[model samples]
Structure formats: C-alpha cells, structure tokens
Target: MTPAETRTAGTTPAYAKGRQRREEIVTAAASVYADAGYHGASLRAIAKRVGISHATLIYYFPDREALLAAVLERRDEEDDARGFPREPVGIGGVRHLLALAAHNARHPGIVELYVRLAAEAITPEHPAHDYFTRHYRDARDYMHSAFSAMAEGGHLREGVDPRTAAVSFIALMDGLQVQWLTNPDAVDLVSPLRFFLQQVLTTSLDQALSRQS
Candidate 1:
C-alpha cells in the first residue's frame, strides 16, 4: 500500500482533529504573514487571529519557524490538489507552468508570502534557507530536463539551450512576481510567461494560452 493510503487507513479521530486544527493554524499564519510580512507578523498575533490560545498554538507548531514551514507545505498541497503536475513533460511542463501562473494570480496573498519568505530565506541562519536552496535546485533540474525534451521533440526554437532557457524562465518568473506585486496594473504575471513560451516554442502561443487546463 502507498504511504498516503496507509496514513489514511491508520488515521484516528483524534489524529484527524489535530491535523485539521494544524491546517487552520497554518492558514491563519499565512494570512498574518501575507498582511504584515513574515518578520512583522508574530506567533501571538497568528494564534489570536485563529482564536486559539498561544500555548495551544505552540503545542501544534512549537515555533514560528515550524508554522511557517507548514504554511508553505500547505500551499504546495493546494497546488497539487488544484492540478499542478508532479512530473512534468516538455510542452506539457511549460503548459503546467502557465497554469501555475494563472493560479498564482488569483492567490496574491500566497505569492506575496512566498516572495517575502524567499527573500528572507537568503540568509544562512534563516529557517527556510535550506528549503529555498533545495527548491531552486530541484526546480532548475526539472525545468532543464523538460526543455531538453522540447528540444528533442523539435519544438524549441533554434540557437536556444535548454538549460539557459530553463534558468532564464525561472528568473523571469521570479522577477515578474516582484514587479507585479509592486504594481499589478502595470505588470502582468501570466501574459509575460505566455509570451516567453511563445518566443521559445515553435507552436501556436494563442492556442497554448487559450486552452483551459
């Protein structure tokens, strides 16, 4: 049996309750962090917003760092649940990324939290430092492989290297996020990604972006 299946089968009523409460706390923390930024938000404020005692909140998260991790983890869970692919293929991988951009547009709060956490995680002593480091490495590897497949399939434009395209794409997405967060009216998130794909790929960009996943 799969680990997820095993966990589901083994989960008790008390464990389920605890898990739900943890999710609630994480959601509350995400909201607090989004509104005030991570450093500006406090565990006490998060617990108060969740209507839970500070001690009880600590019993679940133990510390602010632990709760922050849970908040990021929960967002990833939500992305997966919302149809973000785990193992991405070439064109489909790009398409999935476009879908993700669309998804991020609707969840500005989560994107803001992610960007803020990412910037803060640059410090070696930060709780999420290792997480961001590993995340970028894994993401780069996956995107490089996907673009390589595109090249192999003859979908990628000439004079473009898969690794270069992958890295550039990641950079563009991150940079665009900050710009869009700064000025949503001036900077678009999804359209720029679609245009990037259009520049790299030989196929129809309109159909690609227009297709609803």
Candidate 2:
C-alpha cells in the first residue's frame, strides 16, 4: 500500500505524528521545489533539505508529483486564509482583495510554481489537475457571487455583466502574475492592482448611479 493510504488507515497518535511530520516534509519540499523546478529537484535532495531520511521523505511524498500537489494545496490554504471576501465585495473589500494579491506577489516563487503547474496540469493523469480545476471553480464562484451581490446592491454599473467582469478581473490579475514572473522589475504590482480595482469600482458605481438618475 502507498504511504498516503497507510497514513489514512491508521489513526493512532503515532499516525497523527507521522501526518504532521509529513506536512512538515511537504512544506520543506515546497521551498525546494519553488527554488528548483520539478525535474531539477530529487527526493534525495529534498530529504537532505528537510534533514530527514530519504525513506521518511518517500513515506510522505512517494514521488515528485505528490510533493508538487502538496505545495499547491498549501498555497490554496494560504489564499483562503487571506480572506477573499464573500460575494459582491464592497469597495473596501475589493481593496482588501487587491491588498492580498499584492502581498502574495512578494513570493515570486509561489507565482512561478503556479505558472509551472498550469502547464503541467493539462494531463488528465496529473495529480494536480483536479486540484486546479476545483480551485478555479471555487474562486470563480466566489467572484461571481460577490459581483452579483454588488450589482444587486447598486454597486455595479448599469448593464454590466457581473460574471464577465469577475472573469476579466481575475484574468488580469493572473496575467499580471505571469508577467511578473518573467519581468518583476517591469511592473509595480500593488499599484497596478489598486488602480485596476479603483477603475472597476468607479465605472461600476457610475453606471449604477446613472441608472437611478
């Protein structure tokens, strides 16, 4: 049986401890993977980096793909923790989302990992394909709900499609991160994000208010 299977089957304190250790190993492995691409990184190197036996490392992440998936999961947790504000974000909430993005932008490694995984996740058998699919759907749903609320509350511009706007907004942000990976020096990410939010808010509010006029 696989280590993940074994770990799931047992519920003893030792098993719990093993799970925690595995999480730690995955986190350490993430750091290494972020620095070194998947092909460049090896289990032996990850074990050494985590100061654990090679067998122990393998016990948690049987292969590079598993380790990569763990890293992506960690990233998703972090993003959720930052609070992407529920549907129909107010102006302040939009600012908050931008702030979170700007803060996350500092970790170029995470951005690079995301970019790498985007290409790698195309295969049906890829471990991260499901994770990415779920992530995208969840994120889009959240954005759609928020924008719909805003539109209903007269925060959105007249005739503006909430879903389309949400998609475009997120697309722009994701695209910026991709660009930043190649030329971080060329973009002031925080300021640009803030500007985009302001523009969206202004146009939305004007349209909403104009309709009432």
Candidate 3:
C-alpha cells in the first residue's frame, strides 16, 4: 500500500492525534524561537504558548536541539514553497537572489531567526554549527555554478573570476542583510542589489564593446 494509505489504514487514532499534536508543537516552537532566538527560548515557555504541559512537549521533541532542527526544517520547507531558487542559471540566479531579498522583507521574524542562529552557530559546539556549515557550503557552490555559467555564456566582464564573483556576491547579500536588520529604514536591500547587478552587467557590456573596437 502507498504510504498515505498505510498511515490511514493501520494507524491507531491515538497515533494520529499524537502526530497532529507534534505538528502544532513545532509551529509554536518556530514562532517562539523566531522571537526569542534559540539560546533564549525555553521548552516550557513553548509548551505554555501551545497550551500543553512541559512533559508533553518533551515527549514529542525530547530536547531543545531536536526542536530547533525541526524548526529549521520547517523553515526550509516554507522557503521551498515560496519559489526560492526559481531561476538557477546564469544571471537569472542573481535575479533570484534579489527576489528572495524582497520576499524576506515581508518576513522579518524568519529573517531574525536566521541571523540570530547563524551568528550563534559559528561556535563549533553549537547545535546548529554543522547545519550552518553545510548551508554555507551549499549556497556558495550554487552561486559559484551560476557565476561560472554566466562566464561561460560570455556575460561576465573580462578579468572577473566566477568563483571570486560568487563569493563576493554572497558576502554582499549577507552584509546587506545585517545592515538592513540593524536599520531597516536606512537600508534598501533590493535597490542595492539591483545597483550591483547593473554595475556588473554594464562592465560586461563595456568589455564586449572594447573587444569589438
């Protein structure tokens, strides 16, 4: 039988109830963590927010780290649903990043959660250290491939190295995010990114013109 069918066919009513309750706990925990940061959030407090007892919360998550992982996973699922990485090729990837920044502006809580956890996860002992590590590595690789494709397509300026450009682009995005988080009124994330891309594309055009001249 299919997994869904099996889940409904042989699953006990209590097990189904428990599964639903666990989803509610995860949703509550995500909001708590987003507001308080992982280090400051408490399981008991999350339980209170969900109107469940502390023991019941523990029965589902067992520990803070596990709950944090679940929250991050849920965030990833939401990001995927939002059409993140909709364009994974060449300059389209750069456009996709700008679009993501625009999307982030509407979700301050999720942005705050990411910034707080990413800073904390710099420590090797942090529960999210490995997660952040893999996250950066994957992001860099994707950006690098995108830049490489642009270079191969003759869209990048002369003397521009794809790998270096990718790293710089990622750094620019992260730096802008920090600035925007600190002073949302002063920092316009999408505009700055558009200006950067315009500069890059203009330079590429100039290089092509010089080559033909």
Candidate 4:
C-alpha cells in the first residue's frame, strides 16, 4: 500500500486526523525538498520520510508541483512577516537590514530555494508566478515608503532622492546576499552596509540642510 494509505489506516475521526496528517506531509516534504532541491525530491521520498504510503502523500499534495508551490508560499509569508519594522528604523535601521542579510547568507538552502523558485515563477504559466510578482512589488513599496519617511524627517542628506535611495538600498542587500552565499570569506556584509548607510545619510542630510542655508 502507498505511504498515504498506511497513514490513514489508523481510523481516527476524519477532520482532526486529516489535519494532522496534512501537517506531517508538509513537514516531511519541506525537509526533503530543502535538502534535495525541488526536482531532486520525489513523492516516494516524501512518503518514506513521513512513513506513509505514496498514495497518502498524493491525497494531501496531489502532485509534486502542488507541494513545491505550498513550500514557496509558506516561505514567502514567513519572510513578509519578519521583513517590515515594528518601529522606526532610524539610526539602527541599516543595522537591522544588515543583520537580516547576514542571517539569509548563512542559510544557503533558503537562498537557493528563493533563487530557483523565483526563476521558475517567471514563466507566466508557473503556479507561483503571481505570488512572486506580488511579493517583490510589496517589498519594494514598503522599502520606498520607509526611506521616503526617513529622508523627509531630515535623517538623510538633501540631494538623495528617497525612491532611488530605497531601490539602491534593496539592490545592494540582494546583490550582497548572492555574493556572500558563495563566498562568506570575501564579503563583510554587515560592516559595509552600515558604512554605506552612514555615508549616504551624512551626505544627503548635509545637502538637504544646505539648501536652506
């Protein structure tokens, strides 16, 4: 019998037991997928990990694509939940972003998943296309708003345009993570980010105040 069948064989109440089985399936699939990459992972392996029948896994996920999409969506929501600030970043904002960058850099699996899934999502017909598109847009919008507020508050130098600044800030973090993921020894990700932010703020604030002078 399939792994799915074996799992359901216990004969508990449908609603409660079904929910527990689904969570187990997702947990098993997530670990296998993260270790093996989406294409390398198989339904059989996920079933084996869950100690259920392949049919049981299928009953929950239906197919590999559905399982992969669930993983990506779950990760996106996790990222979003932590990405925005609860309070103003102010003098400490750059450090917070740098810390996040460092954390992502240390976790190569997460980075690899994001890079691979993002490329897949570009095909228009891909299941995650809409989700990835919206994720990027919303992240950019939040960043733009954050920087624009900081600039207007006179925390930034005058000549620095807030929108451009925000874009550059995100771009730098994205680019750095890619590099650091491959060469942690070559990149001082946090220090450099802090330095850059300090310089931008000083130059922009001086220029902003100079306009009044």
Candidate 5:
C-alpha cells in the first residue's frame, strides 16, 4: 500500500491524539510566525502561545526550521482546502485567484505571513527558500497551462504569449499583495485584479471577435 494508505490503516488512538496535538501546535505557531516573522518568532514564544513548555514544543518539532516548515505545509494545506487551485486549466483558474485575493482581504494575518515569508525566502539559505521556489515554479506552470488553454479556446489575443502572460499575471498578483499590505486604505486589491482581468480577457475576446468579423 502507499505510505498514506499505510498511515491511515495504522492510525490508532495514540496516533490520532498525536496528530491532533501536532495540528494544535501548527495552528498556534502559524499565528506566532505571522505576527513576529520567521526571524523574530521564537520557540518559547510559540510554546507560550500554545500553553505548552519549550520542551514539549520541541517534542513535536525538533527545531525551529522544522516547525517553520510544518507551519508552511499547514498553510498550503489550508489554502488548498479553501479552493486555491489544485490545478490550473481555464478562466475558472483566474477567477479562483481573484476569489483568493478577496478571501485574503479578510485575513490580514495570513497575507502578512505569506508576503513576509515569501520576501525573506529569497535568500538561498532560508528555511523556506526551497518551499517558495517550488511554489512559484508550480504556480507558474499551472497558470501557463491555464493561459494556453484559453488560447486554444480562441479567447487569447493574437499577439499574447501564454508563458509571458502567465509570468506577468503571477507577478502582478504578488506586487498587488505587497502594495495592499503596505497601504490598504490607499491600495485596493480585488478591484485592480478584476480590472486587469477584464482588460486582458475582454481585449483578447474583442480581438478574436474582430478577426471573425
């Protein structure tokens, strides 16, 4: 059986309790890391937030890096559960991203964590560097496929390159997040993204219609 299946099959009461405790620790750690950032967040602080001692916290995650990794993994899992693109395919994928931005508007903490960690993870030695690297690679690939599908459907403009468009779209989303985080009152997130999508897709559709006319 697969490792996942094996784990499922072998789960006992003890295993279940351990998983529960681990999830509690991760949830608490996420908040601490979000508030303090990875560099500023301490194991003792997280432990305090979780109402556990440092030694108990260490029992679940042997090191700070391991705890950070678990927090990131948990975030990804939660995002996926919230419909954050298991795969990229069509206009729905673009819509999903916009929806995510709207959802993020309500959760400044999560947004702060993502923006801060993503910027910090640019360093090669950072614990989350590899995570961010794989994240961007996968996100770009999915978006590229989505754009390619749009092109295939005759919804893309004649001169638009799917690969370039995909990259630009991701960059725009990240840039907007940074701007919005910096000044929420001054910068609107979802509106600009919606405007961009309308401009890009509607222009493409118009071009396609013009060709047929």
Candidate 6:
C-alpha cells in the first residue's frame, strides 16, 4: 500500500466506524476461536460475543472462511504488535521471539489455540494449511537469518551451523509449548529459549535485547 493511502486509512467517520466494527468482530472471533477450535466456533457465537446481530456479522465477514481468515490475519498483526518483526534483525530477532514467548506465558489460551490449530492445519486440505506452511517457513528463515548474522559477526558459537540451529530452535519452541500447555506452572517457556540461544550465541541475550530497546 502507498504511504499516502496508509496515512488516510480509516480517517473518515463512516470508514473508521466500519473498520472499528470489523476489528471488534475479529477480536471477538479470535477469543471464541481460542476457546473453541474453528470447526466448533460459529458466526452466531462470535456475533453474540461482539454484541452484534448475526446478520451484521455476516455483513462484515461474508462466510466462515472469511471470518477465519480475518482471525488469522489479526493474530499475525498481534504478533507484529508484540515486536515479532516480519524480518527479524540479527540477534534482536531472537530477542523479540523470546519476548513473545514471555507474552505467551501470560496467555495460555492463545498458546493452546496456536498449538491446536498448527496441528490441525497439517493436512493438505485444511483451510489454514498454507498459512501454517508459510508461518513455519517464515519462522525458520527468520531464525536462520539471525543465526547467520551472528555467525558473520563472530557472535555465533564455534562449530554451530545457522541452518541447523534455526531449525532446532523452532522445534524447541513448538515442543516447549506442548509441555507448557500440560504443565504451565512447572514449565518456564522464556528461560528455555534464553538458554537455547545462550548455547548457540556468544553474545548475552540480555545485552542484545537491551540494544533493541
């Protein structure tokens, strides 16, 4: 989108109200979807949560597919808002993810929803299969670039391959989520990630995060 267009987005009263209504519906839908998986969530339920009529909800999202897509899009927007950049910059990328994990710790329902949907979307025919595919691919590549940058800058540990570390880190996050879901009180999500990064990088996670701040 053009910068000029972005600056004008949702500026008018009617357009802003429409956009606000859409965001409200998406937020409510996300909550409902988090409580109940997409298959179990219904438009009526989402509309009720948003205090809107079913017809109004349909007006905003023509169908279940559209609403589900919006929920996923809003989720990525939330992640971006949480500081998980689309293109992570060096070790700071790792720092952002760890910060995200910390954020996730306070929201187990969101973490559970993510884990559930990621598993559900493994099938080729799943509506979000492509989304998950690109999501993981982006995650892997994000970390790969970070590790690669560290290697070039002499911050990566000796004998560590960026590709391998990147893949392993993603796997670790997925596994940690599963464990944390089952034992939220016992598990320490952010620290495990911090430890993993410490093993791979010569720079302290704190030092890098502070620089980002």
User: Number of clashes in every candidate structure?
Assistant: 0, 2, 0, 12, 0, 0
TM-score of each: 0.85, 0.77, 0.83, 0.71, 0.85, 0.83
**How does candidate 4 score on lDDT?**
0.67
Q: What digit string (tens of lDDT, one per residue) describes model 4 on residues 1-213? A: 645554555433246677788777776777776666566778999999989989888887768888877676677667668655445334344445655767776676776666666666788887778877887776566667656666766777769876777778777776776677568799865666666677677554334324431
- Can you tell me which runs of candidate 6 are displaced by over 4 Å? 1-14, 203-213
Error of 3 at 72 (Å): 1.6
- What would the per-residue lDDT of candidate 5 be over residues 68-136, giving only the tens digit for each residue? 988888888887897665766777677667778888899988988888898889999999999999999
Candidate 5 Cα outliers beyond 4 Å, as residue runs: 1-15, 203-213
- Candidate 5: lDDT of 44? 90
Clashing pairs in 3: none
TM-score, structure 1 vs. true: 0.85
Q: Deviation in angstroms for 125 in model 4? A: 2.6
CA error at residue 122 for candidate 6, angstroms: 1.0
Cα lDDT of model 5 overall?
A: 0.79
CA lDDT, every model vs. true structure: 0.81, 0.68, 0.76, 0.67, 0.79, 0.83
Instruction: Please give the range of 10 consecutive residues that has the lowest summed lDDT in model 5.
Output: 204-213
Overall local distance difference test of candidate 1? 0.81
Which ten residues in a row are the worst by lDDT in model 6?
A: 6-15
Best by lDDT: 6
The window of 10 residues in a row where model 4 has the poorest summed lDDT is: 204-213
- Report model 4's TM-score to 2 decimal places: 0.71
